[model samples]
Target: MRRRFWLLLPLLSLAGALQAQAPLDLPQQAASAQPAEAADYQVLDFDWQDKSRQREVPVRLYWPAQAASAAVPLVVFSHGLGGSRQGYSYLGRYWASQGYASLHVQHVGSDRRIWTGNVFSLIGRLQDAAKESEALDRVRDMRFALDRLLAAEQGAHIDRQRIVAAGHSYGATTSLLLAGARPPDAPAGLQDERIRAAIIISAPPFYGQGAPEPILAPVRVPTLHVTATEDVINVPGYHSEAGDRLSVFEATGGQRKRLAVFTGGSHSIFTDRAGTGGVTLNPQVKAATRELTLAFLSSVFEGREEGLQSWHQRWKPLLARWQ
Candidate 1:
């Protein structure tokens, strides 16, 4: 069992490198909607040290320049494997502009540093990043970052009850673990009760694990799953179909869950990369994704489903499924 798990690590860690080979035939829009500019929010960088684990957790916090009278909502984001704190600036800026604090946590062990060094050793690095130890450390990085954030001066402005966990690909797996996923032989105390909702983008399955239902049944938080029909992960010996995302959504235990499947896009389209998916559709999907996240947040925090309905109406043409 351990050997089989080791063999699947490459497929798990390299999920962000999904190739977008699907042909996009959607009607062209006159112009893609742009996210708010960086000037709208205040960006703060932090390099925190976890003395116990001897790990470095780097993070970027995007706070709204225009403060609200009451505490503001917060979204803690985890990036995909091989991504960094700066990878998803679009979502951070947008969320901050709309009165929510966005905290992006970077896990060093599985981050972009693995892409450096000898090209011949790339596979080895990916395997190491996907090891169970590093995966657990990613979760610890998030929890530790949250603790540090809440203790900081700006933490006073954050609305603790409105906190959400979000991520893409491998990071999505992290989000699920925080949302209460229980893999076999995993340790206890993985879930953080502070996360009221979650936004999972292009989530990969728990490889070498038996059935997804048992593994994902503990994720009871309100979840919004975002994926595309072409979000396929193709490694040398393993392949993860876009349908896996749907299966996860189905198995995830939540009565208030929602899913939005774009017609055609690569898994990497959600990242900062603008060209992995169709150039015309990439920005469109990103814009829609950010807006969808905000709508999901509104529904979770403010109990407002109107924004979600409105978003569905506006972006229906780009969607293969929404529910």
Candidate 2:
């Protein structure tokens, strides 16, 4: 039980924190404005089976409706704990409209299913999802998805050189692993060399891990860290402050890394859900996040810092720190 307690602490804390937020009325929003925006891009759903592990990896791809003359860059996204592929459509749609293919991978073990069933069993489910096995499986899911996607017909339209790994919360930790973060207990060769950069948003510390520096020191790829001054996770006996995101940024091993800290927003604001932060500030932060990600991608891939600079200047009022 003690071993299980340690393993479950981080994810359980995250689950509890997110549960504290009001549920998003996504169904109503989907019926109203989501379809209008859907016209700008094509959303493709796939249920991929990794035969080796017998796990189902569900993904939603937001592809540009009008194909670009040149191969488009790809962003493979992983969702946070209790989130599905459908959770971050805003970012996917925005990226797709801008000529980037965003592939959102849903890790079954840690998905929304955990929120179902008897309330008494919730803790057990959370524990299962937080296990190291599930964490490693999330990484393999991304790797396998990439292999399959690159071999598919759409692969010809993707720019292999500009592939990026991105995620929020628990998913951000997964992105870090792909970007070369090596937790003390993590096995070797988890890094995916194909991912040239990473976008880590609201990433929590690897709880129970001694320190982030050694774990993140191996991450050599360019990275963009996004968080809010109020991006904190609170649950019984566990508390992760917004500064944890900065510690991660500081420890990450890359000269090209950038950090963006919004003035005020909750950790869940980055998800598709709305109203958990501030009614007005929620949308503003989302828009800024979308723009910041695009700017970061441009800086890393096109060698253009102008977009980053412009974004910083434009969103300066809402930002607590931009570095």
Per-residue C-alpha lDDT of model 2 across residues 1-323, encoded as one tens digit per residue: 32221243433324322223232333223222122354777889999999999999999999987654679899999988888999888899989988899999999999999999999998788878878888899999999999889898788889999999999988899999999998878888899999999999988776667777888999999999999888887765667778888998999998899999987778888887765566666766787788889999999999999999988777787788988
Best by TM-score: 1
lDDT of 1 by residue, 1-323 (tens): 45332223432434444344443443344135357465768899999999999999999999998644669888999998888999788899889989899999999998989889999999888788877888888899999999999999888888889889999888888999999998876789999999999999988877778888998999999999999998888877668889988998999997899999988878788888866667777778888899899999889888999999998888887899999
> Using lDDT as the measure, which candidate wins?
1
lDDT of each: 0.84, 0.82
Residue pairs in clash, model 1: none
Clash pairs, candidate 2, are: none
